[model samples]
Target: MDVPALNQTSASLTLFCLPYAGGSAAVYRDWQTRLPGWVRLKALHIPGRGVRYEMPPMHGWPELLDLLVEDVQSSVSQPFAIFGHSMGALVGIELAHAIRSRYGHAPIWFGASACKAPGSRERKLDWLSCPEEEFFDQMRVLNGMPEELLQNREFMELVLPILRADFHLCGSYELRDREPLECPMLVLGGSQDLEIARSSESLSAWARETRAPLERRELDAGHFFINTHRDTVISLVADSLARAFHSRGSGVLPSRSYA
Candidate 1:
């Protein structure tokens, strides 16, 4: 398995971290420190990100899910959890369904942050066909990309393809009718995240996607709540994972000594 930092410790649960659009596995490199010792953070390295920069980024949902499923199967020997933010949240939802259908087992827990539930809204942007200047203008308003990258023409040239590909996938998303997930789901959002315009009621819509009771939380922050409230996010994740282990009859999660 190409699982990073696998043999370093004795972990009982594996947490698969998915990044948002224009993001890579490296985004969660520091997450393990805040997680419990029994949980191992395996950040999913999607194509065209980080070390895989040489490869082209995926542009469609089917192809992306197929590739992800193949990569994830190799690490399914142990109990695992799934976490994603923004665009990553959408990927996590479909990926969970795929994993259960293929491997016959759902993740112990699913964590979705700062994203609208699939099919909840009909708003669409022609991101794939949008002119570079217009798209860049939108990115500036959305504030998802760094100002430095947007200002640097060369940097923009290099990242624009990946950004457009990601947005294309996001814009083209159409949720299909399917069975709800069997595991407990934790839906989190920012109180002031204008990007998604998510409210408590809107966040609760995720309940339709899970058979188990859904847990919803809102951080007193903006769109990027995970970074703004890292401590709170990590605490919630650890607590949710612990409960998941307990529910699966895996017993309680082991206590960790954080230095």
Candidate 2:
């Protein structure tokens, strides 16, 4: 669990992103171009998707975590923050705990999107076991996947399994009662996402537990707020990072307002 030292030369901060279930690092590939020069964005690519298409998908949370920590350790070296949505949100939270326990340094910020706080009542629609058409319908309801892709048979064939596996992981996750994080937490929710209930209040609970700065913003979109509000989301993230850095040092970039 010992976290490796963050890269000091590349930039002052790095952002380690975790994708939604059935997603890949490719989702955030363009983020580097969008973020400020001082921040480096790196997306954690879960196997069995994208570049690792041949590998089998992960079935359990612990197994997935072990794989992820190893992968992240190898790919990242700088003082970094974590941003995860839905399934990725849980990963980010657990990863922060792991890094702190092992490396002794918590991330400067933790951005959790589209997920309720840990220990919330489980909502088990079970996309993995649902019929193909029904499963896609569920995704459409959540507004995560694109409309064009929904009708593309070939695309669905390629992406559906990964999505199912991710849903399964999220469905199966069991929270271990633990203390709240000490790092600043930012929770984002989609105003129209029905799949995740009470996302704002649940995420806000993190503030009470961590006793750290917690802010919740509801976007006028569905579960995939990152897609619909990319620029706005990125700007908010940049502002948060600026504030975190400014608090850490005497002078840094001035914080900007969210759109």
Candidate 3:
């Protein structure tokens, strides 16, 4: 795992970000510029991607979560928050749970974006079981990457394994049991992403995992809306960060939404 430090501010709240399936920390390269000066963004680059490309992806939850927990444990420097998209959202839950259990500090807030609430998935998708052609077909349906990259054999060869590993983690994951988190939860779903969870109502299932109120909002796009509707997504998160910090009577605001 690789986490590059960005937005080093003294009075800051660190926001540890995780990327969607098949995505690297590169996806959040511009976030540091958009977030306010009081927030430090540490976008984790999971192994086998970004600067860690030589490494292999972990296909199971236990190993992946262990790495995630370790990465956060070593990198976090202050009161922190977590924001993840798609597969990252699921990973964030386990990461936060682990952080609280082992380190005894829950993030001030949890932001889950473009993912269904755990256990609410409509159906299991074993992408690993699919033949190569069929698996790429699903990729076409997801449309996360550019069509040209899908056509580029060199790029596809490098990325397909990572995607497969990530999908295996997502499809096979089960939330058997865990205690609710102490901090608040914010859930963001794409308005058109019914293939995963039916709708925002389905996203609301996240309420079961947090002691604080769950805030669910649906953006006007599909599963990959984080790109198509990037500005809106970022602004919503900024506003939420402001609200969460202010609610705690923290003297500093973390996002420009308050300004």
Instruction: Pick the TM-score winner.
Output: 1
Question: Residue-wise lDDT of candidate 3 within 109-143, one digit each (tens)?
Answer: 89999877886764456776777777777777666
Give candidate 1's root-mean-square deviation (CA, Å). 4.8
Clashing residue pairs in candidate 2, if any? Answer: 1-102, 6-77, 6-78, 7-77, 7-78
Model 2, which residues run further than 4 Å from truth?
A: 1-11, 74-78, 121-127, 146-154, 197-200, 250-259
**Pick by lDDT: 1 or 3, better one:** 1
Candidate no. 1 TM-score = 0.89
TM-scores of the candidates are 0.89, 0.84, 0.88
Compare the candidates by lDDT and give the number of the best one: 1
Q: Write the residue-wise lDDT of candidate 1 on 1-259 in tens digits.
A: 1212222254487788899888888778888888866787888877787988888988888889998888789766678789999888889988888898888867889999888888674546688778888888768756677778888999988888998888888888888888988789888988777766734455778888888978898888877777778888888887777667667775344453332
RMSD of each: 4.8, 5.6, 5.3
Give the local distance difference test score of model 1: 0.80
Candidate 2 lDDT score at position 4: 30
Model 1 clash count equals 0
Candidate 1, residue 156: Cα displacement in angstroms equals: 0.9
Q: Each candidate: how many clashes?
A: 0, 5, 0
The C-alpha local distance difference test score for the whole of candidate 3 amounts to 0.79
